[model samples]
Target: MTSIVGYARVSTRDQNPAAQEAELRAAGAHRVFIDHGESSRVVDRPQWLACMDYLRGGDTLVIRGLDRIAGSEVMAIEIVAELGRRGIDLRSLTEPAFDTTTPMGRALFSINAVSAQLRVDTIRETTRRGLDYARSQGRIGGRPTVMTPDRVEAAERMRAENHSYAHIARVLGVGASSVRRALGAASSR
Candidate 1:
């Protein structure tokens, strides 16, 4: 037997899922899952994972809107396709056209998937250009190293004393990678 499973989500803790829950219940959902303070860009959502684990083949997954499942159309289409492959259905209460049970819904999602891929490609290209410009200006990205000059000196002295990289890192309150790099750089000079 197929069961209706509803899900609600809020991007931040300050938002509430009460209204979505009410609507899902009204739509005949027997169980509702919610995720709070979770980003849609992140796939490792706790509540969503739980909802997936509980869902069985032939069950319908319900949501207030498509965006509740995925922020990007590509991801949205992929998720729906995955569900379809599992013999599951997807429905959105707000968008009547968002019903995957209908041919129209399936067509729309296919088009949206292409647009989503384009969007992802555009973002990657723009980011690449921006990074290139930043590099040309001598502005580097990424977090600065934790190893200071004093730490480097200490690391060198410790290495000369035959201390292990892990031991040096523990005494300096840094990582073994940092110790190894510092020692390697000092020796190279």
Candidate 2:
């Protein structure tokens, strides 16, 4: 008798997993593992890893969708391939055609895999173009700076008066790391 296991995850606690759980139960899953507040990008999720450990060659693993297993298409395909190599069956409730346990299912899975790969490639290309454009425009991509030259000068004066980094940051309404960086930049010049 092969066991059927279901895995469900939501990236935030505010989201409900009730629908996914109901679907898994309706599909006759013997056990269901739920992970809340876990990002789909993270592969080290406790429940997900535990589910993999509990599965055997004859067992089946079910998920709400490919995105539920992994945030990225590459990651989803890799995980699905790993399961196939282990002789474990994968069933997506949302994409019932991707069983991978039957010939037709395998073909369908192949199509989905190719589609996922294309999507990832397109996203990567778009991101590269966007970053290149931003770089050419001389726009910084990360968080905006919170300190100005005046703030740095005031922080330097405070530091020269033997004030602690924390005190200087508090007085200037900035962070200690900001004060330190400002001082470092000043000294380097």
Candidate 3:
């Protein structure tokens, strides 16, 4: 038999999920799984995993809101698509258009998924452009290298003296890999 299963998540232990659980129950959910102190971004949330395991084909997964299930539009689309693939339906107590049991709802979901994908693509493109601009400005991102020019010079002298990279790194208080890379870069120059 098909069942209506609900999942709810709260980011902090101080937050209560009773209100969401109550709403899911009112919406005909036979069982509600709640994850306290779990962020919606975490797909491995204990209660959410349990809920997914408990659900069967033809089961309807209900949520008070999409935010209870996903942290981003991409995540929401992925979860909805997975449900569709598993022959499970999704319903949002607050978002009526998200009910996948109806043709209109399914159409709306597809539109929303497309919009979400566009937003993700736009963000990715914008970030790439920003990084390219930064590169043009000679500004590098990520952690600064610990190997200084002086260290490189010293490492070279040590290497000339037949010292191992590990020994040079120990003297310079840096990783052997960093010492090797600094020497390698200096040699290439």
Q: Pick by lDDT: which candidate is best? A: 3
Model 2 agreement with the true structure over 35-143: per-residue lDDT tens digits: 9999999999999999999998988898888888888879988998999888899998888787876888889888989998999899999999999999999986988
Model 1 clash pairs?
none
- Name the TM-score of candidate 1: 0.72
Give candidate 1's whole-model lDDT.
0.89
Comparing 1 with 3 on lDDT, the higher-scoring candidate is 3
Cα misplacement distance, residue 171 of candidate 1 (Å): 7.6
Residue-pair clashes per prediction, in order, are: 0, 0, 0
Cα-lDDT of candidate 3: 0.93
TM agreement with the true structure for every prediction: 0.72, 0.73, 0.80
**Which ten contiguous residues of candidate 2 have the minimum total lDDT?**
93-102
lDDT of 3 by residue, 2-74 (tens): 9999998889999988999998999899899999999889889999999988989999999988999999999
Worst 10 residues of 3 by lDDT: 140-149
